[model samples]
Target: MMRRLLWFSLLVGLLLVVMPAAAQTTSTTAQVPEAVEITVGDEVEGALTEAAPSAEYALQGAGGMLINISLISEDFDSYLSVRDDAGTIVAFNDDSNGERNSRIVGLAVPEGAVYTIVAESYGQYIGSAAQTGDYTLSVSEAQVLRIEYTQTVEGELTSDAFSLDYIFTGSSGDTVVINEGSDDFDSYLRLLDASGAELFSNDDSGGSLDSQIGPFVLPSTGSYTIRAGSLSGEATGNFTLSLNRIESQAIAYGDSVEVEFTNNAREHYFTFTGAYGDIVTITADSSRTVDTDLTLNDPYNSQVMFDEDGGSGFDPEIDSASLFADGTFTVILRAVDSANGTVVVTLDRVPPQSLDEGSQIAGFSSSRTQIPMLFTGVAGEKVRLTLTSPSGNTSSSLNLDVRQDGTSIAYANANTLSAITVEFTVPNDGDVNLLISEYSYTNFQFEVTLERVG
Candidate 1:
């Protein structure tokens, strides 16, 4: 009878094990939905148990609209699977350490797609120790942001001028306005396109003291950058920029010279002069193809001067042209395009007559009435005189007195050296006096050259 009772007790225990409450419910019905909550700076959780096969969930639409997914579970030894409604496994997380309790899984979902998260025991476990845990799921819409910018110049924008306000806009229909404040600095504002291409930029206007404010239009509906900074010849300042939409043409002068395009082609002329040793910088800009040429021309319409070829295309640069005589000259830039566009050109002249190889002098005396010197100059022309000594040293004084046929043509002192350049036309043949005198005993050196500026 006791043995019978023992056998009955064992049978009852087996029945209880087979009908465990947690294991029975696992296969009885579909998995129930769970809730997940999150706060800023907190790691997202709740995916581990929700992704189990026993807790089946379905996602809707294309996957791209689904931005992100996350899960958390204390069952570190368990495995989790994430799938779409079509049973496509999108993500999985597994841990073999049974002692560890925390686990997480995440995936970026495709837009307009359905997804499911499933958790299950790794191996064949008929009823793995009555699996039980609380799980939560959460979904939120993704955010997209974009910006567009445009700039325009309304009136003359010059070196010392005021510009009008600028405007700006955002993807969510937000707006801003920028104004030029008094800061005494030259500033530049530009617009960029979606592909990181510069569409427009503006500075001071040609021959003007102030720059005008204008509107800039973005080429497409996407992201963009608007930049502002100080340009050359001005101090830094606080300026305002705005975002708005308006219809206007972006007309920018290329450099110093103002160029206009009527039929997509035009030409302009300019002139410059300097000492024999100075260098000049020339710059040109055009929306269409352009060509520049610098030539030395005679007064009789004959091309007697140098004609350095100014190459084709926009913004051609050339440097260092020497003057051989004292006369009028011309530099020309030609811009052309099948499409209508404008060109702007500028020339920065540095007088080359300041010094060359011939202006050095050697002497040993504190007081000298007349000092003889030799200089190579243009035939029949007088040479300008310049003298230099140690700054703040009056003892090392010197004077360069220039003469032609015993008549004083030019004189220069060490203190006033830079402003003493003289222009004298050569008579086609003769010797000119290049004299030097010492006011006190001090070593001195200088450079001299002849310049022809016709």
Candidate 2:
């Protein structure tokens, strides 16, 4: 039988009160026997020597319980490791608590297994000839928290600056929102990875004095931290912290989004990929009782267009032309005030197309807006224009015109249940504009065909 000697060092503190050491056990066949029983809120003091490099304790708790273990030592660097009864390593920590101390905080233990926690010195990494020292080991239970809860924290700022941290576990492609807007202080927010690297930061992004940091799509799966603080670095007061998971709909052309705006002021985002010279149009229709607003942003997050009542009545529309680049565009739908209603939004693209002589174009005239078409003609060429409204629908009527260099060449109008055609000869070789103006507002389809004639 090999006798293992246990050592001890002293640290005077409330949570660091010393306790007697447990019997040391050596693994005979890679299986350590008779671990010390350490329950929650218990602190055990022991020493490690180069001869006996590590100490083990048995952690007993229910599944889903948050187990926190810390190794605090001022004499030597501390390190920790956790393993199950099968000798399989479950978790480990080194230098995570700062100042060379070791800590494994908020580790969830599953059911049906006894966990062994080992604490020792960081041998070669510490670069010290004396590899043994005393450490105060503490095992405590923490409250398990959900991700979507709103917490109100009242704190004052110190010279070191005041900030609060909340842990969140997320997978790839998940969008998380952190909001700290329900207070009077100017708020700031930052999203960080496990290593404390900033992924995204924002100050005053939630509008006014509030702060918001997402709809941020996580790029990887792991533990992330959201930090909330004051933008002034010294402001203090009561504030509300809200952490939540949000779902955004994938949207593009020909798709409509059903939206409702509560009194809390909500905004919805949509994405569209476009190219230079492409004209993208977004229209919103709301109930007569609700007034809506629309905003389009380029890939660079620059505002492309914003409309409060550009559409007929209180509806909103955005017609963007000559996009500067090719990438995904973002559309934000909002309400003019606190209102709840359904809004049907549509995305329309008008890419550049050639319309030479004898070319025809078809489109819908239900928007009660002007539709413009471009065509080319040679000098001394005679072109024919036609506008045919939907027959059997008496509500359909439209006016058409041909123009060059802001000068009109020919014009025609069709009343309800009628059609119009006009012919004209071109004086120069260039592009001609065909304009369609709505004579009456109704749901109908109209077509225009062009032909060259002597």
Candidate 3:
């Protein structure tokens, strides 16, 4: 006889073509009887024996109604099948929702179509060794729970329904965050049509045993489904499911936006329009409690830069970077390696000032550490760049970085030098940044002079 042990693979929802011409329910004699009439919320008790091994019931419901059928049996490994009025099986199962018993879900037969529910032991239904037992078959309407925005719902991961399902509606560009947390089980979360772009996930990608999916942007306007269950199939317990909507705001050239992260969400996103050939800087700062990570993606969804701990301690900053494309760019803010908290992100556009031959621009290193400038030079032409601190000439530290097409052609830092002066042959002509930083925390002002006397 075919015996379904729980540890064995619990295959469900497979068509059975070899069902015996059998009978059912407290009888040894085989009978060709009509299908019993039933409806939702009906439970019928029957027996499956070698001679009388199967029984059928006809269901009447409104058209387009979704329903679930279950065959539970302690005395036998149950099998189930549902057929429409046209005699085409709509659904069948050997194990339903990770159990030895059977269940058919989302069975939406045509309106006015009759659905026949068949129940039998696995072995007898497939024409194998004879088996007999009592069973309880149930039919109910399909239920899809909804996790509302900012609402936390308590749920249980039970064997009968290993995966709890919820749905929400979203528009084309809406970003969403979902969290599934549990102290008893390692939670697992999945989106039904999950081929869309995702900004971040938590638990598995967030932190610790909590499970989260999204920071996912909906690609269209419709109902989206979220399935929550245990990461490990063996776990079962109480869990919480939450949904949060992320509102993206436009960022200007030089403004700071502060956002927070909870255990439910670990990442946030912002967008900005940048012009081609623009030089910009971005910084993310938070208290010591938060470790920030930042990612910049161009309009084509390609990553322009990523930074972690490139700012002050536990913060992230992208310094003096060039933007080659003119379009809307995305900035991703994330918390890494620690509990989530508030983070302030700022974008600064550094307009290039002319540094022509024998010209000098007085600049200061205050909150902004780098000053961008444009200097045109021939491929083989050499030039000398000089820096002087007004607090005292050559008294403060400085650096000069020249770049072409985002690649560095020449770089110079004061290190142990008393003066910051660099001379190099121009490599393919572009722009550079003359930077003065608080070396040893000594605040100072400085000027950079470009000379063609190389």
Candidate 4:
């Protein structure tokens, strides 16, 4: 047992994450069979020596109770290890919140039982003669945070204790949205049932590297746990946690709703009723300077279709999309890349633009605002697509992308009315897309012509 304690003490610096605490300490020069008697809230002074290298104190508590243990010393770096009746280490700490003093917060005992608290110098057992020190050991009940729906709270995560849990109660059929935002660290969040089963988890849905879960509908009426933490275990900082109960907004066909993007990574959800196999045209249009994105989800919260830039000038449009199920569908609007701003999303009854031989469409283009046109092509068919700006004297540069399905097959560029001429043999017998955009941020008027060559 003495050799084991020394070996484990050597590992304190290497295993910084979570390892069973080891060691003990005593004021007496000789070792004792039973540990010194101590109780919660009582400050006991003890010293580590070569003869009596460690000491253990017994703690008795009820089931599911959480406790905080601390070992503060002026002599040397202190370490604390907690063990159950079976002598198995359950919790341990060498430092708390980046401090040298040892402390463990929110340590919960699943069942009512007695445990042993071991105290010693950081490297005392490993023969570091400088580890001899006097430490004040204390224990106290842990604090539990209770959250209410629609309420927000400020929280912090230290390097030692990087995660915190908050409890809340919700009724069945309620939709809840949880947001954990932090500028200091990337946030990660999880919701667990009373039995500690994780129902949902999220990372980076609450916009700009924040974590969000929901509009998640509650499965039953009961208390729930929200574990607020960071995306990286080493990340430590302050954060804002919010619990919001939301109602799905309703939208109808032919309705145009303007959404103001609050962040670069946001999920703005809306609902609409759809009939079986009904084709709908949905478009999310923003300023010609920004790119927009959107997704269609079925009632089950499963995505049906997504579009990033299918609309005119860097907008996302799901044109003539046939619904497979008849129910309330969800539409989530988002910003593409760094394009965060306002967008007008409309659900209209229209047909997808399909260009044929000799067909031409005139449009405007700007940097990051690309205009995409659809065309049908047969396999091995030779075709030429040309984009001319003004009277061959347009400002800014234009680029052309020939894509089969969603993958770009060819690329070309031009500066003025000097048309971007790219001729290629059709790789497949399907729909081909031509995306035209300006390389320079300036806006330019352009006309795209598609002609099949014999």
lDDT of each: 0.42, 0.67, 0.70, 0.73
Clash count list over all predictions? 72, 0, 4, 6
Shift in Å, residue 204, candidate 2: 14
CA RMSD for every model? 24.3, 21.5, 18.3, 15.0
Model 1, span 138-216: residue lDDT tens: 3332222223344432222232222221223444322222223224566655554433235555554211222222322
* Most lDDT-accurate candidate: 4
Clashes of 2: 0
Clashing pairs in 3: 23-52, 23-53, 202-206, 203-206
Residue 192 displacement (Å), model 1: 57
Model 3 has how many clashing residue pairs?
4
Ranking by TM-score: 3, 4, 2, 1
lDDT of 3 by residue, 130-216 (tens): 467888988877676887778889988776676666777778887776878888877777675422212243345334577655556
lDDT of 2 by residue, 1-454 (tens): 1232222222234225433223344454322334688877899998876655567888876354556688889987888888888998777877766578887755556665678888877773354453578889998764333344234444443323345566778888887667776465788777767654568877765556777666567899888776666776446666677776666666776777777666654666677777644567788888665787776656654455567787879888875333556787767777776777677778887653346534454454333345667687688888877666555444345777677655677887766655667999887788776666664645565666777788
Off by over 4 Å in 4: 1-33, 62-64, 121-130, 155-165, 171-176, 184-209, 213-221, 227-238, 245-454
Q: Compute each candidate's TM-score over C-alphas.
A: 0.21, 0.41, 0.46, 0.46
